[model samples]
Target: METNNVLKICPPEDSMKDCKTDIKCPIVNCDKVVFSSGSLRMHLTRSHGISESESDDALKRRIKVDPKVYKEYHCPRNDCLYNINSERHFTNMAGLKQHFLKVHAEKKFKCSKCDYGFGMEKDRKRHESHCGMKFTCTSCQCTYVSVEALRTHCNRTQHQIPEMYTK
Candidate 1:
């Protein structure tokens, strides 16, 4: 059986810090935190007169060469937006991957309980909240309002349905 492995990246409980706001400007004597790598690259270009072409290697080297400055993961999407000294960026590669997975990558949000899918996470969550309309037992011909209820009834009564029907 092919099972769906849904990746839930966002909304980590107890950690509300936005990744876009955590990256610090790596340039010396600069205590600035910006939105994204594109924004930081833009900042380097506009404020420091650094060339965009050389910034990636140069910026990484600067961080290693200088301990005072912090690290940043540049967005892989070069065409990502930058506007008015603010844009998308991440502090870690995981954050970058998460951003890409949520924004740049094409995906379908699926319900863990069923084959239902949605283009947006919000829609899937809303559907899953009350998705339990009804489930029927093949053995006893009993109807249940939810899969959990049906499973409970099956376990208590030992009225086992086929594996295909259970799923």
Candidate 2:
């Protein structure tokens, strides 16, 4: 008969003599040592092909639902209203750092036609629909989706109107 073996992300506190970091691989006989909990999670996923949810569950079980261990980092922005009742909390330092960089850092993507800027490409694309270069039909009260579409419509219909192309 086969017996189920439970996996844990870290050993109990009583077992820690020299392991100050406390983040150790749960795999049997694996001596891999990492500095942070995040690194250990990454090691589990990359090296052992364990999914994030699996590692997270194991970590939670090992840590015994300790809020101090999980919610160590909190967002410092006072004006930012993310989870305002409880405040935005992160599981690790890296997650908090990344949240700060993404939410408060300078915008990376900018629209050339307008002064609008965004942090992500998808936001820029959404803005482009309204602010980016568009083709309008001068002949009638109609607008084409793109320049190529306008050109095709104009070529096919041969509608002669003043100022055929406009930005």
Candidate 3:
């Protein structure tokens, strides 16, 4: 990324012009006529084609990302890499039943940020959210990953507060 790799990312200028080669955006659905930040308004107007009174959230939800969502399972059962797609298609019911029994039952916790360890990812998240232990933030006073993560955050960010006056 340091050196120019031929392509450069930018917004489109007009409908007649082609996108600059430097831009790496290959998301074909892009409604941009020309690559430029200013084309954002044009994109929303053309792509959504919504009424003026439409709420911003409603118009935005019209586009579905399920088509773009990453796959959840790969079914490592045999040589059958039969891609269990996200859109609800089944390759082998037996394979699916076996997989659920094997994988999901093995562990319970998961990291929200990354695919880290957990007895149960849900349990880990639950424990973090309401463990009842007080956590004083170092970066701010509120945001924290876990009580331990909060401690780490404070330690890393070096948060300090003034001492109250005493008699």
Candidate 4:
């Protein structure tokens, strides 16, 4: 004496209105409101701005340099070309040496002065303090190397300096 639920038949779309797909982008809730699951993806790429998060600088054109400077670098990655423009940069042999030692599992560079190590000199320089002599203005966060430089910048600016800020 039990009755099967299948005997009590119901329409397939009896509550299908509430079952509509609400597909949206992974980012912010944009102005565009797409109803279909497939169309939502098309709207995001076509109408709204959406791009892959992957970083790629391979296709970019490298800066030109002198032949003497170009002779220095040996290309850090084995897959990439050995050619590189090393004009004003730090070292010539840095490319190949960096690849052989860094990406290919090379030893690290330890700083003698402190307990720190970096793959690049720029990283080391960034870690160093500014010697309490910043060029930019602390008040308005304006960038300039010296007080005289700041004054020159203020003079050229379209906005007038406030009376209270006069020094």
Candidate 5:
């Protein structure tokens, strides 16, 4: 007859403590430290507004696991509004890498009159306003820094666009 393992008595210990490991916040400049990966995930998702998959990837990068464990790629930018505003989940490393390259890595807005580029559209517009290039609407006598603004003014006033600006 075999003895059941349940019959053997074990020492009392904190099960939660046994499962806990020191994990730090992966976001740059964040000084928070949590005990378990699950707790860290919760912190990242709720406190930092990071997506679940992104937090999972962050956990994977910080923790050691089996070689056969699946890998997940996450956006490293903590201030990325795209990820925070919506639950953007990447299915593969390529998609995440592409998002970083296209969205975070490079400037998305450029000044039309200058070589300067900006990561935010508002920053680009502010810079363009002071870039020394001005477009004036002849009909309304209003000045704008960008041709797009002038075009908008023309549309609002029902003014015809100059032939030179038609293109």
Candidate 6:
């Protein structure tokens, strides 16, 4: 008979249903009754002075995350909304920092035509097509296919166009 080496971590859906009613802390003499496993883990760490590693070990034993899968880094910020379905964990601080910069940092590229901003040059370029900056002659109420054509019309008709129209 061949043995399977893969470790499967199945969620405790049945126990979770029971946890909805009652789930007490594992620490002795602690009468805290939490409604979920996460809350119980938090209670263990905050109220009983249990370290996060200890609570994580106990949780792993209960929930069965693969022991071979080494997940060390975790987002310390409670308000971090990334990875809601899976564990909000990373392999290193650099990865977490990159995620924070990409998601939370201010956009660097600002569109001159509108209030739209983008984090990347390509995204800003893509926005320019729909930015409503098509060559339009305000004096004649005519639209041209190109800025050169609009400039020619303005020069020939002596129609004064706004400086923004040349761009």
Query: Which candidate's lDDT is highest?
Result: 5
Give all TM-scores, in the order shown: 0.26, 0.30, 0.20, 0.21, 0.33, 0.26
lDDT of 4 at 23: 46
Q: Count backbone overlaps in model 4.
A: 2
Q: Give lDDT for model 4.
A: 0.40
> Candidate 3: what lDDT?
0.40
- Mind giving the per-residue lDDT tens digits that candidate 6 earns over 8-89? 2322323312223246687788787764456676667567656578546656445544555544343333456544234545
Q: What would the C-alpha RMSD of candidate 6 be, to one decimal place?
A: 18.5
Q: Candidate 1, after superposition: displacement of residue 94 in Å?
A: 2.1
Task: Please write out the lDDT profile of model 3 over residues 1-167, one tens digit for every residue.
Answer: 22332222211223212212112223467634433322343345446563343443344555532333332333433333433322332333333433443343344345454544443334456665555555555347665544556655655667653122111
TM-score of 1: 0.26
Error of 2 at 108 (Å): 2.2
Task: In model 2, state the lDDT of residue 122.
Answer: 52
Please, what is the whole-model Cα lDDT of each candidate in the order they appear? 0.59, 0.56, 0.40, 0.40, 0.59, 0.57
Q: On TM-score, who's better, 1 or 3?
A: 1
Q: Which stretches of candidate 5 lie over 4 Å from their true place?
A: 1-75, 88-131
Name the lDDT value of residue 113 in candidate 2.
71
TM-score-superior candidate, 1 or 2: 2
Local error of candidate 1 at residue 59 (angstroms): 24
Whole-structure CA lDDT of model 5:
0.59
Order the candidate numbers by lDDT, best to worst: 5, 1, 6, 2, 4, 3
Put down candidate 1 lDDT per residue, 40-143, tens digits, no spaces: 87677667877657554556455433444444444444465511122344555455545554565544778888857754465577778868576788897889
Candidate 1 global lDDT: 0.59
Model 6 pairs whose backbones collide: none
Which residue segments of model 2 deviate by more than 4 Å? 1-73, 78-102, 129-167
lDDT score of residue 27 within candidate 4: 56
Per-residue lDDT of 22-65 in model 2, one digit per residue for the tens? 35689998889765567788777667767568546665445444
